[model samples]
Target: MDLELRHLKIIRAIAEAGSLTKAASVLGLAQPALSAQLKRVERMLGGRLFERGRHGVRPTPLGELVLHRTRVVLPAVTELQEEAVRFAHAFAGAPRFRLGGTHGPLLGGLVDRLATAHPGVPVTTYTSWSEREVAQGVGEGRLDFALIGTCGESPPPATDRLTWREVGTDPVFVMLAHDHPLAARRQISLADLAHASWTDVPGDGCFADCFAAACARAGFTPASVYETDTASCVHLVQVGRAVGLCRATFPPTPGLVTRPLAGAPLSWRHLIGWHPGAPSAGLATTVLGHAREAHAEAVARNTDYAAWLVGHPGFGPAHPAAV
Candidate 1:
C-alpha cells in the first residue's frame, strides 16, 4: 500500500496515544479497522512497528524511526494546508478571521474592537468552556486566535505553532445572595465560605479544579451541590441556595453580590493566543489591548470589585490611569 499523509497522521496518533484503542478513539476509527490499517502499514514497511502488550502498545525500533519522520512530515503538511487555505480565502475575496475562547465579558469588547478596526474583514467567534480546546483550535489553524484563561502562577501551556501573550490577570470573587449576611462584607475569606454549598458551571473542569484547590488551601473541602448553567447558577446564588465562584470582572447580577476573595488565593491570567504565522497577529494584539480595556470597564461598573481593586493595586489592569 502506498503511504500518505493520512497514514503518517495515524502513525503519530498511535504513537502519542500509546494504544491502538485510544488512537482509534482519537481518530474516530473503530479499533478493528485501525488494527487492520496498522497491519497493512506494517506489511508495506516489512516489519513490526509496535510491540503489543496487555497494557498498551509500545513503539519498536522501527516504530520510533517512522514516528520521527512522521513528526516532521505532519507539521510540514499542516503548514502547507494552512497556507493554501489562506491563499484560497484571499483569492476568493472572502477574507475571514476566526476567533475562539471560553466565554467571558471581555470577549464582547474584543469583538467590537476588531469590528471597528477591520470593518472590511469578516470575523467569527466560537466559544468553548475548555481553554485547552480553544488553544488547540488556534494551533491547528482552525482559529486565527483565542482568548484563554489560566489559573495560578504557572504559565499557560505553550505550543510550537502558536504565540501567547498575557493580556491581564483577574482576581477571583465569591458570588452569593445580596441579602446574605456575608455579602455585606467588603471582602470574603475562603474560610468564611467553608460550609457554604457551591455550584459551578458545568463542563469547566479547570475552573472547578482551581476552586477546589483554593478551598483545600483554605482548610476545608467545598460542598459541591450540582453543576448547572450560568443563569441557573446565578439564580441559585440569588436565592441563597448556594454560593458560586466568579471573576472580579464578571458583570453584575441583580439579586446577587460578589466580593473579592481575601488574599486572592484564586485568580486567573487572561491570555491571547494566535498562530505564529497568522496574518491577523497584529489584529490579535489589538484585541488583547481592547480586552484589557474591557476588563477595566468591568471593574469600574462593579463598585464592589472596583473598591477591591483600589485596595489591591497589584491585580487588575496594568494601566489603571488609562481606564
Candidate 2:
C-alpha cells in the first residue's frame, strides 16, 4: 500500500511498544494482524523495520532511520491539519473584515467599500511591507482578505494557499520635485533618468529586481538607489536628492510630480486574495468587485494619472478576462 499518515502513526506505535504483540494491543489489532501489516509495510519500504531479540524487539538500521524521519513528519502533518481547520473556522465568527495590505492607495478604498458592503461587521487592517506576510496572514486565517500587488505579470504571492483575482494594473511612474527639470514633461523616458539617483520604499517583492532589469534594458546602470521607508523616499525626491518610482495613481503632492515612464517599462498589478476554503470564500467575488470599484475611484481621483491615461489606452484597470 502507498505510505500514508496512518502508516507513520502505526510505525511510531510499534517502535514505542518494542514488539508486535504489545503494539497490537495498543492499536486494537490482533498480534498476527499487526505482524501481517508490518510485513507489508516493510516490503513496500524494501527493508525489515524490526528485529526480534531474546526479550522483545529492536529497530533495525532502516527502522531507526525511518523512525527519525517519522518523528519530524508526523508532528508537522498534525500542525498543518490544525492550521487548516483554523483557517476554515475563522470565517464563522462575528461578521467582520480583516484586510492586510502592502503600501498602496487601493487598500484604503477597499476598506471603505468593504465597510459599506458589510455594515456593522467590524473592519480591521494589518499593514506589512512584505507581500508574503500579508498573503501568509490570509492563508493562516489571521485576515479575511489581502490587498497586494506584484510587478508586471508576476504571480501573486502564496498561489498555493490562497485564491487571487486581479483588480487592476497601473504603469509605474516617476515622482520628481515640482521644479525638477523632468517634472514639467508629460512623460519621462527611463533613459532620461539614467544618471539620476533613485529612491523607493523597501519591499520584499521582485519590484527592485524588476527595476534593475528595466534599467539594464535602458542601457545604463542607475547611479544609486536609496532603500528606505515611504516618507524618506518621498523626502529624498522632494528635495531633489533622488527621484522616486511610484504607482501611476500616487496622490498629488505639493512639491512633487508623478510622471509615467516612457513606453511603460514597469507595471504593477493589483490583486485581492482569500483562502478558498474559508467562510470568506463565498464573498471572494464580492470582494473582487469592490476592489475593482476602489481601483476605479483611485484612477479618477488622480487627475494627473487620469489625463495621462487618455493617451495610453491600455494601461489602466485590467479587463476581467485578462486576469
Candidate 3:
C-alpha cells in the first residue's frame, strides 16, 4: 500500500485538531471511516501512528514524522491542482475565483456581499488565523484574493508573486462595559487611561500585536492585568477588573460597548491582496467587484454607525466626535 492524498489529509487534520472526532468533523468523514483509514495508513507505514488515550489520540513519534511529510506534500498537491486548474480554465476560457479572508465579522460581511452582489460567479471562500497562512494561500495559488488586516509594522513578507493594496481602515476602539465610568464619556484618549489596568488579547500576531504596538506608540505599556482568548473581553471590564482594545468593527457582544480611542494614531486597515498572475477577465472582475463593494459598504456602514451612535443616548454625545 502507498500513502495517498486522502491519507495525508487525514493525518494532517488529526495532527492539527488533536482528536479523531474533530478531524472527522473537519474532513466531513464518519468516525469509523476515519479510524479505519488511519489504521490503514499506520499499517502501510509499519508503525503505530497514534496512541489512543483517555482524552483523545496523541500523535506518536512516528505519527509526527508522517505529519511533517504530509504538510509538505499537501501544499505541493494543492499547487499542482491549481496549475491544472489554470490550464483547464485556459482551455475552456472559464474563470474561477478563490477568495480568502481573515476570520471574524469582516470575513462574514465580505462573503455575504459577494454572494448577494455577484451571483453568477463561482466563488470559493477561505479563511485562516495567521498571516503566514494568508500569504501562503495567495503565493501558492490556493487563493486568488485575500481580505486581511495588515498593519504597517508587519507588512506581508516579500512574495515575488503577490500584490497588496489598502482598501479600507477601521479605527481602533476601546471596548468597555456600558456601566463603566469611561463608557459614559464622549471620547477618551490613550492618555486618559494610562494609569488603568488593561486586558490584552492573548495571541502574538494580527490584531493582538496591533493593540500592543499601538499602546507602545502612546509612550506607555498598558499594565496587562489580564490576558485571555475569550470572546467576552469587555465583560472583564463589566466586572470592574480590566479594559481591552479592539477594532470598531468587532462584532457587538452583549453587555459590551466600543468607542473610538481618542488621540490614538493606531487603526486597523482592511487590505485586499491578490496574486500577480490572477485571473484578469470574466469571473475575476465580477468577484473583485463584489469584494470592492463589500469593503466600500463596510466603510460606509462604519461611518454611518459612528454618526448614528453619537446621538443615541448613553453611547456618546449628540454630536460625532472627530476620530
Top candidate when judged by TM-score against the true structure: 1
Ranking by lDDT: 2, 1, 3
User: What do the candidate models score in CA lDDT, each in turn?
Assistant: 0.79, 0.88, 0.66
Candidate 2 Cα lDDT to native = 0.88
TM-score of each: 0.86, 0.75, 0.59
Query: Tens-digit lDDT track for model 1 on 264-292?
Result: 88887777888766666657656667767
Predicted model with the maximum lDDT: 2
Give the per-residue lDDT of model 3 (tens digit) for 1-323: 87779888888888888899999999999989999998888899999899988888888999888888888898888768766655454565545557777654566666677666657766678876666677677665667777777553356643455676555555667777877778887567787777778774543256556666666777777776576554646668667677776666665566767777765455565666766554533444444555556655554555533564444333321111111
The better candidate by TM-score, 2 or 3, is 2
Q: Of models 2 and 3, which has the larger lDDT?
A: 2
Model 1 stretches with alpha carbons more than 4 Å out? 25-30, 90-97, 116-123, 140-142, 202-205, 320-323
Worst 10 residues of 2 by lDDT: 82-91
Q: TM-score of predicted model 1? A: 0.86
User: Residues 14-109, candidate 2, lDDT per residue (tens digit)?
Assistant: 999987788899999999888888888999999999998877888999999999999999978855874776666664667777889998889999
After superposition on all C-alphas, the RMSD of every candidate to the true structure, in Å, is: 3.1, 11.1, 10.0
